[model samples]
Target: MIVHSFPPIIDSGCRMLVLGSMPGAASLQAHRYYWNPRNYMWRILYALFGDGREPDEAYEERLAFALRSGVALWDTIASCERKGSLDSEIRQAIPNDIPGLLADYPNVRAIVCNGSKSLAELTKHFGDHPEVRSRELIRMPSTSPIPTRDYRGLEDRLEVWKKLLEL
Candidate 1:
């Protein structure tokens, strides 16, 4: 099993936090969120921001934009054991200290789970907490390539995410 190395990166100005189940191989290797070419995160954000921007922009640039726009990216699990990079194969999942992270970033008001796995883990672990109960839970499509086998394109998957930006 590979060791989970990165700590969550959150913005003090983040009004919304997007949580995924765990990082995939590309992300872990790049030490950045959505590092895989197939990951739709960058594309979706570029669509939200406007076209002239290429999805190939630097990772820091993308992260800076999200931080400036009050959006934070992280994962639900602090650590987990998996033989491979697939989120679907993650075993011995342990929910991270989300409340502590939220407390550190006081501006966060809504929590958006990247998919059902994250939502399920969050609910399973912290659903009873007062802060968790108060936060808005958004269930959006997973950006992992694994999910696309059963779903449509990123544009279709990101429809709910666009609506989320309105909030």
Candidate 2:
């Protein structure tokens, strides 16, 4: 079973949380979030915060930059059975304790779901709960290299993700 080993990079200062469906193969192999060179999650963040300098090249620095900027990274699935890294292949998925984290981080003003699966999981866990439904849920395109008909490249996807760090 593949499990999310990356702990939530959240603190009381966290104003936004970006949730991915789960770590892709490269990320899980490297024990880092968004490890794939083609993944634009880091590149988008760098553009928004680091002035377009290379950020993912330094693993720890990238994470620090996220936390320092009041953004946190995590996955919706705590563990799952999947032959590959694709979310479509995921099975027996166990969701993370998003409600608990939301309660712990009262400073969180918004939740930016990085993909459709992440948003669906949150809706599954907290759809009827007033506390969770109250917050703004900004669903952005997945940063995975997996291409969809709507978004072809990072630039197309980056424009949609800009609101995640637009504090």
Candidate 3:
């Protein structure tokens, strides 16, 4: 199966860009980033910036919240062939035009990769680009529901994700 990333959720005021490797099956079907309820991305964001409540269920509201927090969302892979939602399954990945987006949005001062895969892809494709190198680059643990040895609990992940507040 082939998957394609959505257009960036961004604005001129955005100072941080969050990049995922690609949308999972649920996100693709729902036409929204991190649509999977099990994903920790929304929860983490809400906890960090919202009024200590659960994230709004509406997609537009979530985007608005991110933008208001000076954050943007995108993916490293524009398109790829994959059997499942796992980044490990992706093949022949084509990177998104990150440099072009950075050129257009000069206010974006930091790029945050949601997982190892996103960081690896970003480095592979844009490591040398001035637009990428000149800004802060961060790699956070994957917010996917899948468990990892290092980041098994939401609190553990949240602890690291809290760094975004400092940026």
- Best model per TM-score: 3
Count of backbone clashes, every candidate in sequence: 0, 0, 0
Measured against the true structure, the TM-scores of the candidates, in listed sequence, are: 0.90, 0.93, 0.98
| Angstrom error at residue 88, model 1 | 2.2
- Least accurate stretch of 10 residues (summed lDDT) in model 3? 49-58
What does each candidate score in C-alpha RMSD?
A: 1.8, 1.5, 0.7
lDDT of 2: 0.84
* Local accuracy of candidate 1 as per-residue lDDT tens digits, 32-132: 88888888877777777545367646777888877776778888887888866776688888878898888787778899998888898899999888777
Error of 3 at 137 (Å): 0.4
The models' CA-based lDDT, in order, is 0.79, 0.84, 0.95
Candidate 2 lDDT, 12-106, residue by residue in tens? 88888899988888888899888889898998888887877877568888888998888888888888887768888888888888888888888
Rank all candidate structures by their TM-score, best first, as comma-separated numbers. 3, 2, 1
Off by over 4 Å in 3: none
Candidate 2 minimal-lDDT segment of 10 residues: 1-10
Candidate 2 lDDT for residue 36: 88
Q: RMSD in Å for candidate 1, one decimal? A: 1.8
How many angstroms is residue 92 displaced in model 1 relative to the true structure, after the best TM-score fit?
Answer: 0.7
* Residue pairs with backbone overlap in model 2: none
As for TM-score, the candidate ahead, 1 or 2, is 2
